[model samples]
Target: MSAAPKGNGARAARTRGPVHVIGAGLLGASVGLGLRERGIDVTLEDLSPTTVALAADYGAGRVRTAADPAPAIVIVATPPDVAADAVERALTSFPSAVVTDVTSVKLAPLLELTRRGVDLTNYVGSHPMAGRERGGAIMARADLFVARPWVICRDEATPAEALTLVEGVALDLGGVLIEMTPEEHDRSVGLVSHLPQVVSSLLAARLVPATEQAIGLAGGGLRDTTRIAASDPELWMQILGANREPVVELLDAFGADIAAFADALRDPAQTGAKRRIADLLAAGNRGVGRIPGKHGSSERFTTITVLIDDTPGQLGLLLTELGELGINMEDLRLEHSPGAQIGFAEIAVLPEVAERAITDLVERGWRTL
Candidate 1:
């Protein structure tokens, strides 16, 4: 695991030889596609031959042959349940190659390898915080990791060269690098990623028993909150199981918060109950405000809602007019009522342009709300 070329110097990096990718799933295929885009040779493998072939046909990489030379690096992108085993096999099969896994939970696989008494000097655990609700190679995209945070977990025993090779791959794929210990990475993802998936799944599960009338009244808030709930349950089960301790602790704390809120609402006439409810809601607002805005900053913007008819090209015409007015929309969301003929477009723009955007839309024979 000698030092790989620095940055994305294409020629220097391309000389590093074939990068082997195991699993040929969404993350693995995406990694291959990205590396190939940088002129690096990539070889792909998966438990299912059909999956590997699909990824190769999609231009992720070529299938490995016996005549293929040894790879410089091997990325284990198998599902969480089999990640440790695949990593172990990769290390043994490609002794000189630096081995890394992109598993969601880091500590579990590391501990498993340690328990098996496997030599981990060539192994470095990493995770790219990017994915889609769907899985498999068909959904893979070359830019999946672009502008996303990729965590590298390194300990004192991790060789510098091994760490550098993994970091280079992350950087080559347009990922922002962050270094963390195994414990820290697990806990961080447990809170930010795993917890949210669990919460969203449970919230959406509640809808299964709801009446059609109740579900028909759903709005953007419900849709946005439950979007990730559509993710594969089998995959999430493995992730949640691997990071059980931290996720359980987080769920307990969240349950307590829910209980307190319920108590306050149930006793509105009690002393300070209204104040308690308000305080809880205010705390939520502050917590949301703490999330990084754009480019990891906390900048705020203003939102303006405009009404559009459900007829074809109406929304496109509105956007065309917006562009003609030189208004840059920071973010946009469209929500429609069931069986209604109209929809609302919630557009986020700089605070200075919000009033003007509303006025311009109104003057142009469009409705604003």
Candidate 2:
């Protein structure tokens, strides 16, 4: 939990200004689009003229050409290496305005800015913990940040007005605010964000030489595990490079875990080896428990799988029937088989609704796999 910077809510409200979203990438465009939808004036900018134009065309905001006036709140959403420079440019471009960023690692960028004697008062650091594996403005969604934790890093010199302005933009975009120190943000993300990218990429990279038959056999588990491997390499390089130390530390720990897991598998001692592997798996299960439950509740889900044709309208029809049944789906995934018309759709619901949903769907001529 973070204490609000010393300021009255009324005073902070009065100081709000037009939000300028820089970079025009997915994260930036999403923020701009969401804010613009709230009737807030938003200006968008990107180094590439085409990107800026496309993002504006996508309803992010009006393009901030050179002739436009300086914006009130400037958000730098560029790569990690360029983020501090972008923030400096924003501050220079809009002297009286608040400035922040959507970069993952904060400490390195903050340190870089500090070395240049930049005005820290009007600048705060922010990282919205939401993104897609895809990149660019075209993948932007107005609700990308909805209900996600948007972490803000503030120092003593950071102005209350500046921090509040950023939080206001976050709230307007339907995000919950979280705060931490710059170093804390960097270390935490190195584990949660950076490490996952590296691990997923490593896993996916191994499939390059896999036989077509083997690759074709991949299912939901493999897809879910390696989904982040589809992320933009250029952007990830910058992020991982900037947060190298903490990421390296985490990688070392993960490497040790992997070695232990391997040793457990190779060991001939039956009981002890099985116990070792069980302990590692139990640790993983406990870690997963720390993650927020569906809709923020602790209740477990009961999953029901329905097999259907893989043709068009089949998925929609199934969902329509469930909708008409007034049965809410907690989670669902389609498992399509290769060279087969039928696919299994796994649907998750509340435990009490699970058996009932299965029975109803099956009674309606849908196959429950």
Candidate 3:
């Protein structure tokens, strides 16, 4: 959280302004940037002077001064462990302002605040399911919340005006709001976000001791699976620790599946071993189908892989030709290997236009894979 001195041009146009962001890190700076661009007054605050300066210099917002008016909402973007402290401070500092937090785990902070006997009527816990592989003001994007799930954990005691103000900020930042209780939000994120980070990091950790040749053989699949392993471990440590109960339960179930699969693979000679393996793999397929986006149901769309030269403007040209052909690309994934002369662009399109998309690309002197 930070305090940047406010500017004069902010308007109460669509919604309210004077949004006090208390942590000028990734989420905090991003919220400031997003709201500032929309003509809303955003003040940046952080314990670190360099962080607040960096975030303000990046045009997130100006510094806050003692003369600044009370904000309509205070967004506490602190780490999970200290989020409750930040929220309590915000509530105390601005008794009339609606305070919210964007920390990953919602329940821990809510429980901590409740246990401390803090006033809860104005506090709304939230988690915006958006981030890059990295953190900091340097990586903050104004569009970070666009089309992402922003979970609002509002209790019955929360007033309508407070909820509206919080939801307004979410919608203004292009977030799709989803309402959940603190417990529901934590449990859901444990299954979807926290568990995946643990899995990805552990999976990537396995490659550390491997030989160079084995590492060289890695491709898109390995990269995709291990990508989040690059996330900030110190931050994740606090997050995973704060929401340990649900995450541990998920890990236990996941570990059991892994052990069962390994056991089945060890004894193909057993009567039902092969069947068990196939069933597990098929179950995996079904599970993947349920994931949103291009990875969703296979029957919903068709994917065409096109080869692209490792040169400037090659990908742009392919995309340009797709537009010229009037082919709507539903989703896209790019895969390139080190020192390779070509890259693969997997384009997802409607099933009806799949054959046409491939034929059109081939006719345009493009290679298809």
Clashes of each: 0, 0, 17
Per-residue C-alpha lDDT of model 2 across residues 1-369, encoded as one tens digit per residue: 243322122132322547788899899899877776666678888899999999999989998767767788899988778999999988987898889899988899988999999877889889998888888899897777867789999878777777888888877776789989988888998988899899999999999999999999897789878988999899899999999899999999999999989988998486688888999999999998887754322134677889889986998999999999989896787778879989888888878887889889988999986
Ten contiguous residues minimizing lDDT sum, candidate 1: 292-301
Candidate 2: 10-residue stretch with minimal lDDT: 5-14
* lDDT of candidate 1 over 1-369, digit per residue (tens): 233432343444423658999999999999998888777899999999999999999989999989999999999999999999999999999999999999999999999999999999999999999899999999997778877899999999999888889999998888899999989999999988999999999999999999999998887689879999999999999999999999999999999989989999998999999998999999988988886653212134687888999765988999999999999887787878767899988888878998999999999998887
Report lDDT (CA) for all predictions. Answer: 0.89, 0.84, 0.88
Each model's TM-score? 0.82, 0.83, 0.83
Candidate 3 structure quality by residue, lDDT tens digits, 1-369: 235423222434344978999999999999988888777889878999999999999989977889999988999998788889999999999999999999999888788998999988999888899988899999997878877899998877889999999998998887889999888888999998999999999999999999998999997689889999999999999999999999999999999999999999998898899999999999989987887774532434698999999776999999999999999897788888888999999898988999999998999889898
TM-score of 3: 0.83
Clashes of 3: 17
The candidate that wins on lDDT is 1
Candidate 2 or 3, higher TM-score? Answer: 2
Between the candidate structures 1 and 3, which one is better when assessed by lDDT? 1
User: Candidate 1 regions off by >4 Å?
Assistant: 1-15, 294-337, 342-369
Alpha-carbon deviation at 225 in model 2, angstroms: 0.9
